[model samples]
Structure formats: C-alpha cells, structure tokens
Target: MNSASDAVKEIVIEIVNSTPFWTAFSACFIAYLNRNKGKKLTAEKDGVKFSLENMNHHEMTEALEDAKKIMVSDNGKKPT
Candidate 1:
C-alpha cells in the first residue's frame, strides 16, 4: 500500500487499540451497536406470540409470567 494509506490505516488501528484515555473508537463503536438493540421481552405459545421492545412495569411482569407458564409446560422437552 502507499505510504499515505498505510499511515491512515495505522492511525485507525491505534485509535481502536488504545484505551488509556478512553479514546478507543472500538469501545464506543461496540457500545453504540449494543445501545441500538435496547431491551427485548418475548413470549410465545402454540400459535400465539407476544413481544415488547419498550414496556411498562405492568407489561413486563405480565409478559414474564406468560413466558414462565410456557416454559414450565415444556417439561424439559426442547423445541425442534
């Protein structure tokens, strides 16, 4: 590669690898990717299903209970 391109590549690698000043680009990039996922809550039964990305306390509780019931009924058997 050309010197200029090689220098740019080296700088990017250093930015991603350095952590002393918490200036690592990779750290921020990973955090940004995780931040986009948010929280996911889901419940499914036979042919029915429910999902929540953002939910209230009441909804969270209800969804969790539904999930528990479905899990209990599975009785150690795994889905195909």
Candidate 2:
C-alpha cells in the first residue's frame, strides 16, 4: 500500500510538471490545424451571409470587383 501510494504521487507530480509543455504542444497543434492559407472566407451584411468557398470563377471575380468598388467609394472608412 505504501509503495503504491508513492507511485501514484510520482505520477501526479510528473503530470503537473509537464502541464505547461503539453499545453504549449496542444496550442501549436491547434494553430497548425487552423493555419489560414487558402482557407474559405465568409462575408456577412444586414444579416445575410455567404461563403466564398461556394463561389465559382465568375462569381468570385464579380465579388472582388464589387468589393473594390465599395472600398473606393467608401474611401476606406468603416461604414455605419
């Protein structure tokens, strides 16, 4: 019983000491999973939402042009 309790205490101590490393590893793994290159983007306005992932070539080009026009017209200020 005494040796068994000592082994459990050692295991607990090891886990506590390794917490920070495991936490960092988990964070890096999650960040790698969420890396944004080539990720789908969604736009929302007036409660309407659409995903660019579903758009094809023509639609995507048109959306890009519309976005450019809006930016130019707004002079780059946030719209209220």
Candidate 3:
C-alpha cells in the first residue's frame, strides 16, 4: 500500500519523463516546418540566388552525422 504522496510523486516523475518526448517531437516538427517557411520567405524577400548542388561525398556524410548529433543530443541520445 502506498500513501497519497507516493502516488503524486509517481505522477510527477512520469510527467517529467514524458516532457522531453513531447518537447523533442515538437522541436523536430517545428524545425521541419520552418525549413519550408524559410525557403518561401527567402524566395519572397530575396530574388533567385544560385545555390550549390554538388558536395563531396565524404564531407556530406560527415556533415549529416554532425547534424544528427545535434538533433539527437537534446534527447540524451546518441547517433549510431
């Protein structure tokens, strides 16, 4: 048998654990959406500008892994 305090403590712990899940999800969702918004805003405010298309394969892979680390770091997770 647990006291009322114990139940409340469990609920609080659960909420705390769940918070980062929601926060990371929302952050990722918002970041994805912002990319589209950024493109649109850039096109509207700035005229067509040339962008690089080609990237070194090795460098590109490294850059991607770096980005993954940043995105996953907040969740206390690491990239494989």
Candidate 4:
C-alpha cells in the first residue's frame, strides 16, 4: 500500500510538472489577468455615465483636442 501510494504521488507530481500542463495553465492565467486589465475608463457628466473606450479613434482625438484647448485657454497651463 505504501509503495502504491508513493507511485501515485510521483505520477501526480510528474503530470503537474509537465510542459504541456504548464503551457496551458500559463496561457489561461495570462488571459484571465488581461481580461480584468481591460477595464474601460468611465465618466459621469450631468448624471450620465459613459465609457471612454467605446469612442472611436476620431472621437478620441476630438475629445483630446478639446481638452488641450481648454488647458490652453486656461492661461497656458501645461498638462502635468
């Protein structure tokens, strides 16, 4: 019984240490972490909430330009 248990333990350890298992596990873990890292920026104005990530490139550029104009109009205060 002792020898049988030891063999089983070794087999389990070997399986856990295998390259394929590690590769699959790493891929899944990285995907999970990236999924959570992709949280969109949110803003609330006039009691309306919206996500910045939903904007297209043109819209993003326009918004950034508007922000720069605002900053420039505020006595040439450079953004930190």
Candidate 3 local lDDT, 28-70, one digit each (tens): 4445434433321111112223221232334323333312122
TM-score of each: 0.28, 0.26, 0.26, 0.37
Q: List the candidate numbers ranked by TM-score, top first.
A: 4, 1, 2, 3
- Greater TM-score among 1 and 2 belongs to 1
Model 1 pairs whose backbones collide: none
Highest TM-score model number: 4
Model 1 over residues 1-80: C-alpha lDDT tens digits? 57998999988766534443223322433343346564333446444565544544444444444222332121232322
For all candidates in order, the CA lDDT equals 0.43, 0.45, 0.37, 0.45
Q: On lDDT, who's better, 1 or 2?
A: 2
lDDT of 4 by residue, 20-68 (tens): 5545544543444345454434434344444544455444333433121
- lDDT, candidate 2, equals 0.45
Q: What is the lDDT of residue 42 in candidate 3?
A: 11
Worst 10 residues of 4 by lDDT: 66-75
| Stretches > 4 Å off in candidate 2 | 1-39, 44-49, 68-80
Provide the RMSD of all predictions against the true structure, rounded to 1 decimal. Answer: 16.6, 19.3, 15.2, 20.2
lDDT of 2 by residue, 58-77 (tens): 55444443231211111232
Q: Candidate 4: what lDDT? A: 0.45
